[model samples]
Target: MAVIYLVPPVSYTCPNNTTCCDDPTFDTSVFKRTIATEFHLICDKSWLQSFFQTLFQSGVMAGSLMFGIASDRYGRRPAVIVAVMLELCTGIIAAFMTGYWSFTFVRMITGAATGGIMVVTFVLLMEFIGTDKRSMFSAIFHVPFAMGHMSLPLFAYFYRDYVQFQFAISVANVIVLIYICLLPESPRWLLAMNKVNEVVTILTKVAIINKMPTDTIRQAVEQYHINYHVSSIPKGSVADLFRTSNLRRNIVVMSFTWFACSFSFFGMAQYVSYLTGDIFLNVFASGAVCFCACLVAIPMLTFMKRKKAVAICNATCGVCLLIIAFIPDGILGMVFACLGMLLNFLVFIIIYLYCTEMFPTVVRNAALGFSSMMARVGSMIAPFVVALKPHGQWCAPVLFGVLPLISAVLCLMLPETKDIRLMTTLEEGEAIGQSSRKIGTK
Candidate 1:
């Protein structure tokens, strides 16, 4: 995301004496060296700015598909490790790159690795949690995501140079790399894949970690698998996603929801540059606001059905965005914009868990990956929509606002999955995702 939003080296008046920075001679003393300054992404070349953003997002989209499929085929632990390594390597490479194309190429790969980390880790986490606890852990899982956003401004403030910033962020990946030895593969995934022995060992470790009786937990799993005929459960693939009518509908609906969320979130994000305030403060405040929303979502998810919560909040977000579209950029507009972001992020948490519940274990990563891919598409198009602001100030907001309302309506087509067990088989996945019932029914 930071790669996509590099400050283009452009001429502008200084606040103190209205002194203009000439094009050829970019004052690194005042502006500092960025990709924009280093590669001269300004003036006639400024058109390439958003294009680069779109390309980086494309990298993320590709990564989501590649890693999602790879994790299912191989294992979550390996895929995640590979992505982390790639992310670390790419970040370091980009820092020293002298050519714009080379830097962009490296960043696109970095974006892809990031996309893989997000999609794979999410599925793995969901698989480890029980039905009652998924809501809590799912919401809590995203807190670090918010903190990642918060840290961007904090580090950027100290590291004014792009190279320093890259090193600062990339260095953090080394700490994550240390977790490889400690990281466990999903037990459910192992069972679903027919790796019974591996799953039992993992479960035993989990029991010890939780201070539960290990023998009791292992016996329960063994008995459950034996009684249920776990071997009959088929492995799912990308093609299997479309094998059933209901699963197809579910994927389509979920993909659209993911798309709308990414589009609106990034659309509003572009407006941050236009807001009246110190750039660092506005960005930092935006991250803080989102972090607070993550805390609020923990309770909200417990009280509301997943589908209902997403529908209600997205509609409300749309309304707020509509209001922002008609108003001038001021205190009122900023308030509504923040409100819209809060609601949008809240809906993201709901639909993410909702999508996980709607899909089967075997193809869950593939489905989530595909959905995330569509989200990248939405993000790719967002810059173009925001650029339309020159034609009509309301164009971006109006487009961004209308999408969520449609997605809210589309949410009705998805089955509610508030307290349902994770579906291990495609048959169960199809049945639960297609059928809607009263709140109390399991």
Candidate 2:
């Protein structure tokens, strides 16, 4: 949501054919500065706008790291409440803020909350379900994000008024706040926190909901002695990520993948809105194509081998970007744009699944959270990068095209893990990598 707000505003080109007061406005810039400077609401200073926009990503990265630590130490529910409250407060202020700097500050704060929510949400949802169901749920998670991404342009188009859009975003958060209140605490979090009693209670409720026998769950918990203190579950500092050779490898791969994925995803998402003709039609078409590509990837991965699926997705994305880089701005360019847009969706699902499988339970969320932060870093730079390219120039496409090729090379370094248990421990992941099996042989 924060990305949805910040990027487009910074990219806003003033309407009166004038350059931004703070920076040069490229010919292809979408948001007109005349409207921003004239209206004095949505934007004020160009550099400030860009600064606030990029700050959201940096803040989210820092905030999510803190949230991950807090969730591990305290519990998922409490950390989530902190995030929620922050959301409600910052969101309201952003909606009603009259000054540019004031609202931008609120955006940064709200971005932090958004990041925390994302890290916690994915971890909690996976914990709530059985292991076998995790992949399915993880894939399903992207649908809402895809919907939200698509919805942004639609709302921005219809509202045409900045304050109105902010109000709508705030109203949506109110719904989320109420929704979160009704959800129960994650039992896995309870177990990790050593609150055996609470874990049992939550597990029992979950068993009842699923119409499963609670006795089996209770027996398993007792057998595992979940209440056993794990003093080694130390402060999951980011540095802990490099303690082992295998973990260090996982971190490097995921970090690179995350950055590449974000660059491709947002670079195209925001750029599509700036396409030369029919802004609404172009944005809608691009978003819809990407969403469809995501849907197609789910089944392909389910039936195809994991390594093949990912490798193919990367190759497809690279090829599409390359095509887009060279295509002239006309009918053929439109076709390549649509294809490149779909590849964003494809890359998203592949990277998302791959990242989740790379780490063990001990640091799964932390690794994923940190990787997500890096991805946002890519998103932060995307708007500025696009701003540098001349209108009708293919420079941005060439650059976007190159990142995926590099990502494809990195993808080659990861071991395939299809038809295998999800890695939750450092030792377990390393063993799989060393296993005597075909890389994609199941």
Candidate 3:
């Protein structure tokens, strides 16, 4: 599609003393169909392509805030179901869209739905799993995302038509929507809402399924209620994240880290198109590297302190990007680029685990939502940064390299969260950071 959109320049004869070339025009003879060709999204209107992509991130930003609040107020299961339904409907609508503006509108809505599903699902999984197993499960959870990225090129290869590809992706949501019906609401959420009877009922059923003795399950639930005092903690608001001194600093640093991580990761991914090679091959290579990074991340998260691991990942990623900026464009540069992407991908996995552990359960969803919203800002701007490649090849890579390095340094200010109990209250969370600092001083 990109190749077709990049129409070849044609020569025109000059009548008098000078020779001139006509404006490049789409060549339908080579490739007759594509959104670009169909809409004449070429020449001066090419910026619209980037604009269309940006709108999706904008939607994601909006959706994160919307569904984050909704999940906290309603429940994770309901929020996730709504998001899936939105994606299913909007994706189909986007496929049949004939006008460019209409397609862009649907895509923006689709992006929001995608964001809602992702954030809520992450919180749901973290809430259900044991703290010790979270890092491993988080890594496992990301496998499907990496697989989705890797599968896109294969889908495009087999079904070259844009409409067909859209339908193929959209239809999978139907299966998800059906599956969502069977999922139970988060027990932690029920407990937080002071719905003890509901929590007991759910835990009893879970115990029955696992064949655990009913007495043991009852003892565990009684112990949890006494230890955490879950009923006393008030429902959290978004403002609670900023109400205290330590939390304010934590939010500031983590939000910036999210922005940096996302900006660099997406910037590198988008720039693959500009690399000198088959676009499909470049995309596949990038996805493969990211998948490998996910595998490597499993043990890293299991053994290493989350803060140190993230700092190291960010620094190494920065170095790789720097090398790519200097090396001549070819296999070597592509190698460095892929390496940078791999390390950045590791950083992404570690950060998700870190963020999940950092905040208390009360505001966990809201904090994650705010952080993701900051990330969308980074992602939104990434395309424009990549677009700067026409002026200088190194411009985008240098920007991407520098941000993560800054993030690496900033990471040192955040506390290590590995092996600690997930905080259930704001005061407890603030104390953890303070205690870590006091220990550091010794």
Candidate 4:
């Protein structure tokens, strides 16, 4: 949302020319100083807006890979701290940057950190949650993201200046830092890492919080600790994800799902630009709608298996969007488009849960990291997809409608994760839903 807001599409106007200026000026009534305005990135240099986005997304792609490994290698808590610190530092630096080259550089690094925070924090959350309550927690997890999306425009509306807005958002990381500090290390990660003492401490703390029996917690931890050491789960690698047929299929299918979700979700948001509403209000409303979708998803999670949810949402969203391309721009058209948008958001939430439960604990973050990197790739392509507006009005919607349907078909090929335990070893992951054939086996 900040990315779109950073280049205000409506705030500037032509002062003298009857038709919008040949060499457009960024002079508004309030003198809005966006990156577009400050850099005079109007007519010819307009592609720079997409370029800036690409650079940031490229950073996110790299960061997801790097941090995913880092968390697996170092620890989730440490990796999160490092990622957050880098994000804070680069964001602050970007606010002060005057040179376009320098500012974009900072944005890239900041994006990397942001990506790290995103993938790592999610893995951490899923690892902490038990499967029975996973749906509620995962759905609730997206609330802050939607709220931030809703809040960015509010910040942009009041701050108006790029510098002030940049700095203000940078400071929001302080809250993340505090939250990280207060979190207990994931007992799942700890157990897999053979840090049973730490796991015991974390569970003991949890027992204290829930007012459970500490002795029971400690003895249970001891039994698990002894079993863990006896049948220790070996660490995992990205290569391992591809070696086993089941795990390999899961990752490949998930990668496409992630790509489609990112591509379509952002495409849906940007596609709103073609609509007749106020862009700023549209942005806020879009966020609000997504938040409501998250809330509504709570009940849907009760009955919908992960695979079924994704398939249903994707198919329905695709049909609604296809309908949107034909209809006149009216309340009915808007309703269909909004429904597509809402379903895309639900796919995102469900897919996260799907991904978390499919992979084993050892390589879970790595799998998510790779999927997120693909998601970044999808998002990078989204603007260009939206830019297809010049070719045909139907180009964007048709593609949007088609991609999710393809993903819906792919969703069926995936094994169900609803009743399956979160895998702790490569063997466990490979064993999941083995009702499907194992091709390319050695």
Candidate 5:
């Protein structure tokens, strides 16, 4: 999250600042050259900034899909350890690289590592905790990410004169490596891999810490031994994601959600300067407010069902973005921006949780990786739309509104997973997701 908040500004600031500021003498071509060299590290002619972002993010997403397969095949703990180490090394190398190409390649590798880390960490934490408490814990995990997001702009404001922000981000990630080393492996993963001895040992430790009966824990584990054997390998191609079968609907709905939500989210974020009367102060204030709103989402997740909660948030976000589109450049603009920030905070909560819930264990992380790739496609292209010549003050917000509106409609087609158990196979997910809607149980 820290890197997510930092990297965009660092890469695009040269361009964003120049575009917005009414400096007639400033060369737009210089903005393109500086941003491309720094962001892509590709000094090659014909490289566009958006194209580089797409290529970089697609590689990261593919790497994430592979990591998910590795984790599911091997174990979550090993996968996370390897990913974090890679991230730390790549980030440090990125900080010290001499030329644009070297740094860009290093950052691409770093993105890949970070993608794996994100998926494994989330899956591990959810599997480590009990079902009743999973949503609560998952929501808690997002708070630190929100804090990191809010802290990034301040870092950027202070670090503008130096290019050492990359080094600082790398140092912070190294600290993450320390934390990862100390954390325990997921007991669920141990059980799934048929490592009963390890699972028993971990459960015993957990029972002792919680002051629970070891016999009771063992009994629970014994009752859970129904081996509904499914295919270990993912059958078919990436095109299977779009077939008229179970995987297709999930893919289509998820793809739409990913594209729409991301477009709106980044669209609003990119125009933070224009949304409010005083760009600097408003950006700071809105960031803090959004952070608080993220905290509110935790409790909401606990009390409310996931489907209805996400629907409400999406509807609210769409409305807010629409409102922002119409407001003039004054106090009304600030009001609309604040409303949009609140909605964005809520929409983000849904995105994080819903993306994870929408697939089975076999392809769960892979599904997220694919959806995230699509989202990055939206993110890469969204800025350019607002930057297009015909677009003016209202263009960003209008596009933002349009995107979420589509998301709201597509979301209605998805089945709720609030009460459904985490599925372990495609067949199970397809049956449950389809039947859950028919049975009218969210």
Candidate 6:
């Protein structure tokens, strides 16, 4: 099955002055089934392959906004359950799709659901944990994703059939949906919603499970309720992100950083086949590098200021990618390319934690969703940019390198969030940024 997708179809010459041209046919003797061969997505229809990829990202962009709003209006648990179910159904249907158009449409739906799940899950995790432990939890969060990445090739290797591979991957969502059913709703969300009893009930259970006093949990909830009323923080909308000057600046800069990160990360992943002949090895190597970086990120987040660490990692990633553009194809080139990807992975982890920390609780999901939507834009365009490699090999790498380097510089413009408490209102968020800027100027 791997051989079918990797091998190029045989070419034939047309007779001179012939009215008809030779249509290229794949050698299907070794493996008879694949999405490419099944739909004739080779040769003249090759552009459609790239278009199919873009549709998924477009759906993700749209879904991020929709689910983000839904999460804010409803609750995290409900939004997540709906997103997972959508993904599960669409993914299963996609495996059975016979037509290219139908398959593409299903993929888009899956991508949208996936986008919603990703943002909501991250926010839920952050909201559940203590601020002191968020850095550690954020670092640990990537482990499952890295494991999934590492597991994909193994699944693909064993399944051999595209439909089987799709089904295998989609079935995992069923397990997630079941697990989600048992989890508690976010207590912070309950507090924000003024459901003091629910917050106390959940916190009491948590304390009892941890062998702590339930009275302490109840008192904390009581204190939180009092503070919530005193603060009088209004519910925020998506438009709140751009309603003020400081917020608008933060959004613009952060959005670009998200774009840069996604552009470089996905660009490298997508072009691995072109970068090296050993596609399987490259994929495994990249995933391994990312896994190790996740380990490294735990300590980095624990000790370093978020802004400085992100800036340094982004700069290092850019330089390494730039070096890869000049290195000749060999073992050394592979090493440098892997190093660049590793640094980018580190930057990715830190930026996610940093962004989550920076935004006020009222608009955190909205801000994350909007940033991720910008990232989807970068991801959508990455393949097209990589496609320019046929025109000039350096074009793609140069673009990848430049984007991150620019983002690294932009990192300095944002505030440092180390040791800072999460903001509960837009005014508080703005004041924090302003104070940080004033201190930096001094």
Best by TM-score: 1
RMSD of each: 3.1, 4.4, 4.1, 3.6, 5.4, 3.7
> What TM-score does candidate 1 reach?
0.93
- lDDT for residue 251 in candidate 1, whole number 0-100: 93
Give me the overall lDDT of model 3.
0.80
By TM-score, the better pick of 2 and 3 is 3
Off by over 4 Å in 4: 10-23, 27-31, 226-231, 329-333, 436-442
Query: How would you encode candidate 2's per-residue C-alpha lDDT over 1-442 as one tens digit per residue?
Result: 3344334533445556464443334332444322244333233444454565677777677767778767766777778888988988888788777776677678778888888988888777766655456556667777777677678767766564567677676667777788787777866555544556777788888789989888777677765443334323344556667877766876887788778878776777666655567666666677678668767876765776655666676677777777766766666766776787676667677666666666655666777678888888887887676665555467777777778778777777777765454443455645555663632211
Using lDDT as the measure, what is the rank order of every candidate, best first? 4, 1, 3, 6, 2, 5
User: For residues 39-60, what per-residue lDDT tens digits would candidate 4 score against the true structure?
Assistant: 7675567677767777888899
The predicted structure with the larger lDDT, 2 or 5, is 2
Question: Which regions in candidate 3 have their CA more than 4 angstroms from the true location?
Answer: 1-24, 27-32, 437-442
lDDT of 1 by residue, 124-211 (tens): 8998888788998889888887788778877777887888887788888888778864789988878777777898898888888888
List pairs with backbone clashes in candidate 5.
41-100
Candidate 3 least-lDDT 10 residues: 1-10
Cα lDDT tens digits, model 3, 357-418, are 88887888888888888988988888778878878888999999998999999989988888
Alpha-carbon lDDT of model 1: 0.81
TM-scores, all candidates, are 0.93, 0.85, 0.91, 0.92, 0.81, 0.92
Q: Write the residue-wise lDDT of candidate 5 on 1-442 in tens digits.
A: 2332333332223343544322223232212223333444222332354444444555566567767667776778888899999988988787677665665677778878877887788888866766577677777776766666666666655554224666676777778888898777777666555556677788899889989889776666655534544324243234445554666787777777777776666556656644434434556666776777767877787788766776777777778767766766677766676676677667666666776666666666666667766776776676565454135766777777777766777777777766455665566656755565532222
Runs in model 2 deviating more than 4 A are: 1-35, 38-49, 225-235, 429-442
Ranking 1 against 3 by lDDT, winner: 1
- Give the C-alpha miss distance for residue 324 in model 1, angstroms: 1.7
Whichever of 3 and 5 has more lDDT, that candidate is 3
Query: To one decimal, what is the Cα RMSD in angstroms of model 6 from the true structure?
Result: 3.7
